[model samples]
Target: MNPVLGQVPVYNAYGSVPALPLGWVENYTPTGQPYWFNTITNQSSWVYPMMTSKKIPGTNWLFVLTHDGYEFYYDRDSKTSVWEQPEELKEAMQELKKLEEEEKLKKEEEEKQKALEEEEEAKKALEEEEENKKRVLEEEKEQARQEVKRIKLDQAVDNAEDVEATEMTEEDIMWQLQQMAEEEVGMDREEEEEVQEEAQKEEEIKQVEKKPELSEQECIEKFYQLLKENNISPFAVYSVELPKLMLDPRFSLVPHNKQKNLFNKYCHELGEQIKKEKSQNTKKPENEFKELLESKVTTKMYWDDFRRKFKNDPRFKALSVTREKEALFKEHIRNNLNKKNPIEDYKNLLRHVKEIQKGIRWRDAKKLLEKYDVYHAIEDKDKREDLFRDYLDEL
Candidate 1:
């Protein structure tokens, strides 16, 4: 048996005369010029006594003479034959397998070619899409540029037309001025003639006295009207230019005393408004606290130090009330000492005293501490002596 090509050395059996190596009958002329032969037998090595066959007319049967000279009838209807040699079968199978493999390779190549074409088509489509996008963007940009250019051109043309229509040349301006001067001269001559006529008439009739000018109240109201028209604040009564302002003919009737009284009333009103604003501002706790902190009184300075620093300050001077000053002093002390017992509070204060005298001579620091009654804190004689020596060495 052959595993790859199935069974080899296969044999065929007909009916039972005796089994022989299979041989095929052939068509031939009487001179033995064979036309067709089909056999898988080893007939060249075996001595066959005879071999012959005759096709039965009108039927698919043959009378064959076997190698042993036995006459047998082969019925083609039975379909028994080993007509091909082993080598020929193998060769035919190999050709068929090669054809199948070639067909499979051809199909795979065709599929790969189709896929490549599709990929190329897709790439071309993508490139065309990008090109279209870029073209649209460029067209939009061109349109926008053309729109801006059109706007600028229109503006330039409009400006040019305006200049041409209304702008005056130097010669034209000079001619206009000359014409105005001539008209003024003619008017002056007419006025002179009228004055002469009026003078002649005055000699014929006595003139009545003119009524007195508008009174001070009316003058002041006119002055206020001018100020309102000019948007000047009414509270500007104390402006340095008040005398110049009074030079207007309307204000000429206003007595100086009345003006002084008016200015003083406005000044008082302004002061009252300022005081009201200040009081309102102080009513807010944040504003008051901010002012207190900015004074640097509570956090950075002892009461005595704060008083020493700000004694001349108007706000500090306003602390003249004894109760308020005492309360301030108590707040300062409480902030520094918290709620500690007297002994602890005094010790804390001594720490500040030590800092104040840090660079002074030890003897001087001791004298200062003793002046402040630091010794009263120590009842034990030895501890007091030790404190005295410590103070002396502090510098």
Candidate 2:
């Protein structure tokens, strides 16, 4: 009935035998249709749709005479093979095609998984490289900072101010703070300056003399002078030193056992001396004061200053001064050593902390692993296949 599966007419020698299944026909698939024509057996079959070419016909086909297990035909013109038509075997052929498709799909999925894994590995490697770069940069920056300290130490500013002293003063920084507050609260300069004057005076005295040599007002003037010269912030100075002070010397006085009348009447005398100096040279007053202060703060001054601030404290008195000195030396050494990568940094030490605060550790890796899906597997036949690593996009 259908030309694709032609009817065979059973007849003697010359022509036609009519029957079920036995047939010979040229394939006649329309354009845009997919078919594989086996003219050998005068039969054609469909593979995946829209695959290959259509219509194979008008040629002699091959045959196997020895067994005839499954009939076949060959075309001398096209040198092609075709399967023989057998109506009863159609179901078996369909099953074979289904199995073939399954195999193909399985292979394709495996390839996709492999590609995915490769991409994930590449991505991880890039991330690791970037992290290493960042770590190296951080170490280099730390080294530079240490080198700077080494240079400063070698120069040995013994006759000079300590590192903190060369920095901002309490008065200079406080002035800026006061300025900000005044602007924020919309206050007049006269009121703010007046409030600041007393406070500043008291502060200056404690810093300059740190003993009975200077009074509160004189301290204020000295502080003011030094701040102006260095163009430093007074608040910043106080911020740096407040830890060492048993009490803020300007606002509150803690009369140490070693020093009494810690505030002195040096402001007017120093002011006059400054005025005379100015008459001789036009150099700025604050600059002169800054230089003088820096030159005067010797190592002896550091110990003396500390003693003055803490001498009255019962707690410090409880500790032996000899013991304190040893402790201080040990602390300095440890600080220097801490500038390098410690033994902990060499190992991947995991802490539960999500932050890298004072140390370098391997907790960051564990965290990344936990947050991402790493490996996956698929089962096919008797084999278990690793589906590869999935990518982690931005969280």
Quantify all predictions' global Cα lDDT against the true fold: 0.53, 0.42
For model 1, how does the per-residue alpha-carbon lDDT over 94-210 read when each residue is reduced to its tens digit?
Answer: 554577689899996785566456545665876799689767966875676567557756775685567656777899778756865775677567657866885676555544323
Question: What's the CA error at residue 244 for candidate 1, in Å?
Answer: 94
Off by over 4 Å in 1: 1-89, 165-395
Candidate 2: residue 219 Cα off by (Å)? 67
Give the per-residue Cα lDDT of candidate 2 at 34.
55
- Model 1 sits at a Cα RMSD from the real structure of 51.7
Displacement of the residue 233 alpha carbon in candidate 2, Å = 64
How many angstroms is residue 261 displaced in model 1 relative to the true structure, after the best TM-score fit?
99
Instruction: Give residue 115's error in model 1 in angstroms.
Output: 1.6
Candidate 2 per-residue lDDT over residues 1-395, each given as its tens digit: 22566743222323343222323232446776655554444446664212122122222322322122334433445554345544444565466557768989999677556645654566587679968976796687567656755774556445234456666689967875675565545434544675578569758965885655677667665544543444333123332332333223332333332121222223345456777987878754344433333343332233345446555554444445545543453333334335543233212222222443333333443343232111001113112111111111110
Worst 10 residues of 1 by lDDT: 41-50
